[model samples]
Target: MEASENWLVESLRLYQDFHAFDLSGATRVLEWIGDKGVFVAGYESLKKNEILHLILPLRLSVKENQGLIPDRDFKVCHGGFSDKPVFDLKHVPETRLLVTSGLPCCSLKVWQITEDSDVIKAVSTLAVPEEGNLWPRLAVFSSMAPGVLHGARLSTLRITDLESQKTAYTSGIGDSEVLSSLQVLGTDTFAFCCTSGRLGLVDIRQKWTPSENISPSPGSGGGRWCADIRNGGQGLGPSIASFCSNGQLCLLDPRDLCHPVSSVQCPVSMPSPDPELLRVTWAPVLDNCLAISGFDGTVQVYDVTCWSGVGSQVEPLFTHRGHIFLDANELDTTPLVTTHIWHPCKPRTLLSAANDASLHVWDWVDLHASS
Candidate 1:
């Protein structure tokens, strides 16, 4: 609630279950495998000029020290591209679990991890075609189409059927501003935002034209570093939570992108370096709960329902400070949080990694009870 030092101090609570492990290098990307208690991550290479990737399974229960499980950790190959990879996972149908990732080398790949096995392995599927010589910057599976995959090549959006591997629709997204994030609002409907905080909604059923993007108003030129769309349910329509490079949190409705539902100044420290690196993620189990990170050592979880668009900024519900300590040995030091994510099923749980090769997973206390 109140934006006061006391509320901030009160929100600082100890970890209910803190488990951490350190690697030899920093982690660059992290994605969860649905609600399977498993996640995929990319990290720096211990080997020279090489990178290491992992698909590891982890449970939430923690007491003392916890490390990676043997034989369950699988290494993923980068497929010859040094650039960052964009990947997403689908874990339903329990029997068949798979992940889709955009390779830096102009390809979209699907990897399946088998169930009912003692040892886990990553099986590769056919790669997405390299159309227009554009590297597949992002790839995500469509909710309504089982074999259909929706992807983007920089500012161009491409929807294809994986079973046939044929493109269904292609269109340019907003004057080629370099889309930073894409979210599926419906099977053929979706939203995208550029690095400059320009948001647009596109429906594949309709022909995409310049008119699809509403002309942005003046003084609205800012980078929407990253964004997440909360699915339309729980008595609320689909909504977008975008964090800007200029230190503002914008809430947008998919039906209308030209006007923000609301805007609030974010919690960025003064003169911060590289604000574009910041990211925003919505909790799968909490409709109004979202987490924002990349500003510093800690990841802040805020309740948007409490934010006042006209009043002062609202304090975060819970502040995860585990990475600031860098584990038990290191204290009072803040590390750059490479990435943080909400548990697919656990409402208040979080998994975060730091640039120092440290991973911390904690389930913060319930907000209502703690507050």
Candidate 2:
């Protein structure tokens, strides 16, 4: 394996006096759309609603002699309702649509970013029939169909059309398996991970039949927190990269959902041993590379091009420890890496959010050289 110590890391400030538990009570709420990043945080005081949506332009420029700084050319803040933690944010650049979901609420709000006004305006809001504390863990926008949004609410999955402000389809994943994450596979197909440690694929065109499920080995611990479909140049039909509760990273082909094409263990062990709160995503530009983050407060990147079978073992190409606390005495209080997002256009650029309410941008220098 080739290793390089050439990585540039930058710390970004989101909100003043921000606390992680105040707004969302969780982190994985960062999304990158075009040149802008949308983050959800909570206000410090109780006078206003807790949830605050921050829109930050992510472009960077080098000053004549001031090195590099984010081109703070534009910034916008939108207020949300109280006690509604924004659990997920997704942006569809093609449609200029922004979708957000809050926990304990069944409502999904669709907004449009107006270029002329440099503001986000709500286009429509659709609420699911059910009401619960953990409904709608995440929302995913489909590129195959403009204005079509998919969401997972506890054991149920819902699909809505933003143009009509109506739900197109809804189905329950029986046996009480709560959904943890969602991914769009194709125009009519999508994949979801559940608390039962099973990965399922559903085709919306097929009336949401009994999903084809993949169960991990016995005693491997079931429950997949996050799954992302690979967008490589390879001709594979919608391969999946999933992070499971057993501390396993799995790569599977949705066409053949019975078995995983590759399965490897995560290097950074979770500090709390709770595996149902992690995230995994494929590299936007790399064919077989991906990243995983969890309660470990570290991010790991692995190249699975050589993965062949169940026992296949692949070491991470890079391990990012920038989120770890530098003070030895504060090791016990180290913040977890809530989520990490790859640049939509840049091959080697990645952004990660931590429980400390800070965002870090990591640029892999070696990967850029080879690309």
Candidate 3:
């Protein structure tokens, strides 16, 4: 592991005063996209300043010397009704299109960044379910060359044209349930993890089907906590790393769906005994090593040779003092660690967000002293 010598800090200033309900510190980072070497992030802030407010997209630039800079000078893309917006933004890597979800009145909006105009021009807009809180899910399929681009709501997943708001393909997941996460498994396939503890495979080329499934415990805990599905593992198809309730980690191949190659129960003697709220991810560049973090401050790195292989657990490379420390009853109000986003431009570098409304950048560097 390597360490970072320099650190930069930038604050976008959520709002002068709280704007939302009692959600003074609830912020969810939806997407982080980098083009060439420049990076942009989009997230939703529930409390703007100090007032109860609607959600809106917060944008920032990642640069070496500039630290974190707000995209204030960039052209603003508008949609929906809420003056405040809750958004899901994704970059079409092929076309370089910026797609956004959740505006006061708008559901999905596509925009083109014009270099000459230094502005973001609205490309197209699509209508979506306006009844429930509509959060957009984004995924890309590369099977058909550049792959099919799609989005999923709580009940439906549909493909949309970048230049036209027309629906290319649409499938239903029903209205009574919620989708926890969505990942593009292949050129024509996608994996959906639902709040119902249901994991289903959707084929964009065919009618979406339950090609594979994993049921969690009944009630609210059955849904997946987090997922890492990409084609880097030793397997030929998509490999899944999902955190299930009760401290169980299940790794499966969505291509086979019939069974998981391996499963591991989180070791009990963790730094913190609280139920594990695990966040699992595989490095985009590294296939052998995977990173896992839990509700406690421990971060584990694993050499995934095989699912059931012995002597696989590598030592925990590092421990983080999670942003906040609190008692059991204070969990709800605790300054929870929300996410860890690896730097797209810098390998071995990571960014973390916490309930304290702060973002910290970490680099994997050796702390061993000289002899």
Candidate 4:
């Protein structure tokens, strides 16, 4: 069993490496644009600037075994000092737009690639609150209105219209909990997870009112750190994948959020060690599979096809350990996984970034074949 696990981990081919900046902090955001490009966001504490990199994989022939290389002239953007900046990209068939917040002397900026030029250009800047943390926990483009963007402020969720450069709607989730993440469900509805271990469903068409609230446990404080809505498939309606600070992954049905359809505990050491979940994203091709990054420097893929109810533990399909541990204790780690993202078009490709200023592009086709 141990030998097979080692082989599976070793079969991950290092396709590319992206280390252009002198960034020391862990990457806070990573997004892939189809199979050709990726966007990485990180903060440099010494320089007090946020770094955004747009990397394109070099086109090579099949006979070339030198590995995938980044373009010689990759694009880089620098923002202001922020612990976590809200960064996301919107890709359509014809247009590609990138939205980011928490820049120095700038609240929100929208960038897009022009048809004539490959360079990214600023298109608009949205309004933001004057006080509180400038970093937004969530920033997502609305599915219904392509020009509209929804982002979370300190305690409120604001929707901005990119075309008009105006605030469309703003609502607060009260003072009890902080908004952790947001996932758009459909045209008019979206779901948000909170630090209070609560899940909320909001309908923008209904005057931005929260229609439902589901509290999984009283005082769980393991707040659902991240939530992602799956792309429907396999006779299943839209469901949610949520990861809590206490290392709990729960699958909840949108219709009945009061109880989770399935729940699983993440692998962690004993003595009540709090494992921080950095990111959670569903596989672009596989409907029943999802990947999660942990603060302990591990990335795990879980298959939820058999997940049916609470108290049922779901084992990870595969575990990838790219970051290294410096000391004997797990608490003292060399580098941690800050962000990880699966390829938008390729099911076997994944990209991960760590605080050690390293980026790895992993191809897991061989591992899947072996399994």
TM-score of each: 0.73, 0.76, 0.64, 0.75
Error in Å for residue 29 of model 3: 2.7
TM-score, structure 2 vs. true: 0.76
Model 1 residue 367 CA deviation (Å) reads 6.0
Per residue, candidate 3 scores C-alpha lDDT tens digits across 255-318 of 6654655666655233323322346677666554456654543344554555572222334444
lDDT (10s digit) by residue, model 4, range 279-307? 77888786578888754556778778777
Give the Cα error of residue 340 in candidate 2, in Å.
0.6
Q: Give RMSD to native, each candidate.
A: 6.5, 6.5, 9.2, 5.5
All candidates in order of TM-score, best leading = 2, 4, 1, 3
Task: Quantify how close model 1 is to the true structure by its C-alpha RMSD in Å.
Answer: 6.5
* Ordered list by lDDT, greatest first: 2, 4, 1, 3
Q: Which 10 successive residues of model 2 have the least lDDT summed?
A: 13-22
TM-score (C-alpha) between model 1 and the true structure: 0.73
lDDT of 3: 0.48
Better of 1 and 3 by lDDT: 1
Where is model 3 poorest over a 10-residue stretch in terms of lDDT? 1-10
| C-alpha RMSD in Å of predicted model 3 compared with the true structure | 9.2
> What is the C-alpha local distance difference test score of each model?
0.57, 0.59, 0.48, 0.58
